[model samples]
Structure formats: structure tokens, C-alpha cells
Target: MNVGIETGPVRTGGYASSPERSGLAKFVSDTSAVFVREILLLLRDPMTLIFSLLQPLVFLALFGPLLTGALGQGSTAETLQWFVPGVIVMISLFGTSMTGSNLLYELMTGSYERILATPLSRSSLLVGRALKEFAPLVVQGLLIVVLCVPFGFILHPLHLLAGLVVLGIFGIGVGALSCALALAAQNREWLFWTVQQTVLFPLLILSGMMLPLDTGPGWMRTVALFNPLTYIVDLERALLGGSFTDPDVLQGVAAAVATCAVGLVVGIRRTRRTA
Candidate 1:
């Protein structure tokens, strides 16, 4: 009776009382740590920086001139205008694909399990890894833009911003898909090599990396419609001073959204099992 009388009202925190809150907080902190680690790792690998800068520059110098005659006068100038955006997208794809390699490496070394053993949420790990991949691409894109200024390419600020956003979104979607595929792959190294030829090359061709869709065959044009990279290229073209119809732009946005959604679902499921 005395013990029962000693008992009083017990109160708890409101929304903050939810178990998810602590998990979310831990996830945020862990995600930040992951991002920082990724950046530092990239910094240590000087080759990544060299290649990232050189690839676009080489493409601009080589293909930029070759395609000049085919695109015609004003169009040639306009096509040349696409160099920066194209390079930006290219870097985004390449850089983001590396995320898969990182994930695969983690899986191979059991680092993924270590991370999952912590309180971090799955979303945080996935997103933080994706963003870490994207950050370098952004820096490379800006560097390419800076280089373009000396070449007489006047990039509108809004256009530049829009192009970066598109590239970032596209990169995240593609990177996630690549990561998921890699995770599911029995032989990750072999799969990584094949992805370049299979996934990346098609995206480049369908996206008009070398030539405009108008210059391609009717069937190729139809195929391009289905390629998500086409939208990225179209969005880049629009950002770089070419005409882009509302419907076409909308299609591109849809493709990017769809790719990202599917990839995310697959990646999350795969990671959960592996993690």
C-alpha cells in the first residue's frame, strides 16, 4: 500500500519521444561522416581528379571540332555551346558510377556490415554515399565552366544552375542503379567493367553526346525517346542555348524521376539484405 501510494504521474516527451527521432539523428550524423570520408578518400586519389578534368577537355577538343561541320553554322556555335554541359553530365555519370565501386569494395571488405551494425538509417547511408559521389562532379562541372569562359562561352547563370541540377539528379539516379546492380552482382569487378559498355555507352549514344537527335535515323530517334540520358542531354541543350519544347523537357524529367525511384527501391532492398 505504501509503495503504491509513492507512485505518481509519469510523463514522457511528446513527438520527441518517438524512437525514430534518435535513429534519424544518428543517421544524420553518420551520413555526414560518410560524406566527409568519401571526399577525403577522393582527395587522396589524385588520379581521379586528373581524369575527371581531362576527359571533358579531351572530348571538347576532339569531338567538338568534328561535329562542327555537321551541326551547321549557328548550330555549330550552339553545339559548341553544349561542350560544358556535356562534360558536366559526363563527369557526373562517371563520378557517380564510381559510387558503385565504393559500395562493392565496402561489401567485399565487410565495411558495409560494420556501418549497418550502427544506428544509422538505410536512407542516410544511401543518400550520403550518392551525394558524396555527386560533389566532385559539381566541382568538375564548375571547373569546366570556368575553362569555357576563356573560350568565349558565356554561360547564363540560370542555365548553369539548371544544368547542374539536372546533372546532379541524373547522376544520383544512374549511380543508385549502378550501385544496386553491382550489389546484386555475383562478380562485382567484372560487372563494374561491363556497366561502362552496357549502361554508359547506350546513355551516351541515346543522349546525343556526339551528335544531335535531328541528325540521327528515325528509329534511333524513337529509341532515344526511351533513353533517360536523352532527357539529360536535352535539358543540357536547353541550358546551353538550344530550343527545348515543354513536352520534351517534361519527358526528360519523368525519365530521371523514374530511373531514380526504381534504382532507390532496388538499392535499398539490396543494401538491407547485404548490410
Candidate 2:
């Protein structure tokens, strides 16, 4: 009865109203802003966007039809379906490699040093840069799907989602690796092209991207087994209704994980060293 006299409306403010979670909110806000800025920068580069989008289309148009004839009847549809994943993988690889050029550009202009001067975490800088590549890769992957629709390729939405996941993972892994390499590059400008050609051409040819591994010799098959890109392309193939063995899918997942692990370690070390 005596306690009833003290009852009143309680007013809570400051920490009681909105409690801080864990780490610095300022860091989260700043990193988010940086991510948005990077995405905008990528959007403004029309030529880069166009070239990135068109390269796969051109390859699809030229090589897609050629492989159809090479592989025999009904192979056109099969080959295009096969090429869908390969194109996504190729685009991811190409798109990620461009990170080197972007970083190099920043370095040349002293912008990178300025970024390093900020209170940003090195990991955030690395991740933010990689996030910049994700949107374009997704766009390119969707474009490939659209282009394939007219060619009689029907994709289940679930499978498409799975394929996109694979592409996203591939993009991140490749982008991280490329960023690390770019940091170590003495001449990032010229080395960008060199890395693209050297790393991509073989992966494209051997990963069953353009043709089946059965078309290759024994050594090439062995090489394909070890190539991380092979797993990416094969995973896409499996999702697209091509005949992919269980072992193939498992191998691919393992390879992609390994590549990603290696890339993460390298990217983290490189960022710390260079920053």
C-alpha cells in the first residue's frame, strides 16, 4: 500500500532508449558509405560496364554456335546451357581482375594512400572493394540467363538461385585474389591484362566452359580436376540440367572452398602489408 504512492510514468532516454550493440557504430556507418561509393564509381564507368557485359555475349554468339556443330545434333542447346555457367565464371573472373586496375588507378592518383589514412579497417577496405564487383557480376549472370532463354534454355528459379550463389562465391574469391595480386604488382596497369589472359584463357578452355573435358586429352583432364574454375563451371552445369556426376559437384565445391580460403589469407596479409 505504501509503494502505490511512488508509482509514476517512467521516462527512458539515451542508452535506455537505444542501446549500443557491440563495436563502434561510426565504423559501421563509414564502411557502409565506402561500399556505396565504390558501387557508384563502378556504375559511372559505362565503357567498363559495356565491355564486361558484351564480351560474354560475343563469345556466346560466336563460340556457342561453333560448339553446337562440333558437338553434333542437339548440341547447340546443350552447349549454350553449358556456356551459361562458363560465361558467368568467365565474367566473374574478368570482373574481379578489373579490381587490380581500379586499385592501381587509386594508387597512381594517391587516392589509396588517402583511403588508408582514414580510420577504416583494412578488412573493410578489401571487402568494400570486392562488393563493388558483385553487382556487375550478378547483372552479367542474369543477362546470360536472358540470352539463353531465347535459345530454348529453361532455367528453374531454384537452380538459377543456386547458380547465382556459385557465381557470387566465384566472384568474391577471384576478386579477393586479384586485389591481393594488384597490391603486389610493380606495374598494375600492364599486369592486369597479363593476369586476365594468363589465368582466364586456360581456365576457360580446361574448365569445360567451352567444351566438355571428354574432348580433351588425359593430361588436360587431370589439369581440369585441379582447376578451381572447373568446379565453378561444373556446379553451374549441374544446376542447368547437364549431366554432372556427384563426384564432379563435390570436387568443385571443394576446389572453390580451397581457392577461397587461399585467397582470403593472401588478401588479408597483402592488405595489412600494403596498407
Candidate 3:
């Protein structure tokens, strides 16, 4: 959670020389530096690093087999096809959904303001953090897919790649929104936590990350149709399972684009204001 911590040292004495760079070059350099810094911080804590990835493995270990058995006369292949997609989506969502708390910590410590005082662009700052969060989320997601390989899950190469991109879009959206929430409720920990808890579970349910909507009650199915995440999950499952037909994948792409687009707008505006 070292959102603004430096991973290296710098010398700025009377004898230290400053190097000149072009605008685009400087922008890329700064963004990449922040991105790497966030990554180093993420891996610095052994416990947090492990926990960020362990949930999907836990679910894969604890539920993969059980889900295979519980799919109601469904074959092993069918179970994996159905289960792996949801698990992948869950990995991406849960891995970085709570990153807002890290932002809050930085705010309280004044690290956020310190970073803002620097020359780094606010968009770069937001993108760096989002990309950092996306790194583990994507890794965890692929790990989930790999773990499911033994559980009768089959991978379609192109579809898997497409699914990963969709998962990335979803993670970026969630991470951006998380940052917005943290910035909005900078001093209101209770409200922040409450809002996070309140929105997260319902969204999880609506996304059908743990259970298929088809098997759920009629009301839940109806409600899930409205959730953009529902389309995301549906597309991932379809692609992973090699059932890519009709409008599911297209709908998912559209939804993911829309969600992330909104996230970028809101995140950029809020981040500038917060800074």
C-alpha cells in the first residue's frame, strides 16, 4: 500500500545535474517509474502479496471439485467450463477491489499530497496505480485458469486471450472506481467501508461470480441481467468454454468498454480534485 513511496534513492545536491527530456519522453518515464514503484511496494509485503493471490487458489482448491460434483448431473467438462470463468472474474475483481483503503492510508499520511506536488501527471498517477493493481489481478486470473486445467477445464487460446483482456478492462474499471471512492471519503473511514461493503456483495451476486444465474431464483436472474458485470462473466464463460456464439461476447465487450470509459472520466476528475 505504499502508494507514493519511492523504491530508489535520488541525489539533488548543488552538484547534481538535471537531465532534460522531451515532453512525451518525460511523461512516459514518469508514468513508468510510478508504475514500477507501485509494483515494488505490492511485492514488498510478503503477507499482503500472498493474500492478494490466495483467495482464488483457495476457491479453486475448495470449490472446484465440489462444484464439479454439484453441477447436477453435469459432466466434468461442463462443470469446469462453467466454473472457471466465474473464478477468473472473481480473481480480478477481488484482488484489487479493496485498493481504495491503500489510497486512504496514503491520504492520512500526506503521502498522496506529496506525490501530487511532484511533476507527475495525475492521469499517470491514476493509470500507474490501476496498472499495478491490474498486474496481480491478471496474474491471479491466469493462475485460476491454469489451476482449473486439471479440473476438466479446456482452454481456447484466442478466447482465453480475449477473456483476459475483458478481465483487465473490468479490473481497471473497479480499481479506478475504488480510487474515486477513497478520494471522495478521504476522512470518513466508516462511510468508505460501509459503501464498499454495501456495493461489493450485491455486485458480486449480480455478477454471478460464485453461482450461475440460470440456477438461481427468477428474481435474481432478472436483476443480474442489468449488471454490466453479468455480461462480462457471461462472455468470459462463453469464450473459455468455446461456446462463442451469438451476442454474449459482443454484449460483454460493449459493457466493459462503457464501464471502463465511465471509470476513466470519474477517476481522472476526482483524482485531480483530490490532489
RMSD for all candidates, in order, please: 6.2, 8.0, 6.3
Q: Model 2 misses residue 225 by how many Å?
A: 1.3
| Candidate 1 structure quality by residue, lDDT tens digits, 222-266 | 998787787776777676663445465666667767877877777
Residue lDDT tens for model 2, 44-75: 77688778878888888887888777877485
Q: Which stretches of candidate 3 lie over 4 Å from their true place?
A: 1-27, 243-246
Error of 3 at 79 (Å): 1.2
Q: State residue 201's C-alpha deviation in candidate 3, in Å.
A: 0.8
lDDT of each: 0.70, 0.73, 0.77
Candidate 3 lDDT tens digits, 4-61? 9654434332111125654777667666867887888887865665786687677766
Q: What TM-score, computed on C-alpha atoms, does each candidate reach?
A: 0.83, 0.84, 0.85
- Candidate closer to the true structure by lDDT (higher is better), 1 or 2: 2
Worst 10 residues of 3 by lDDT: 9-18
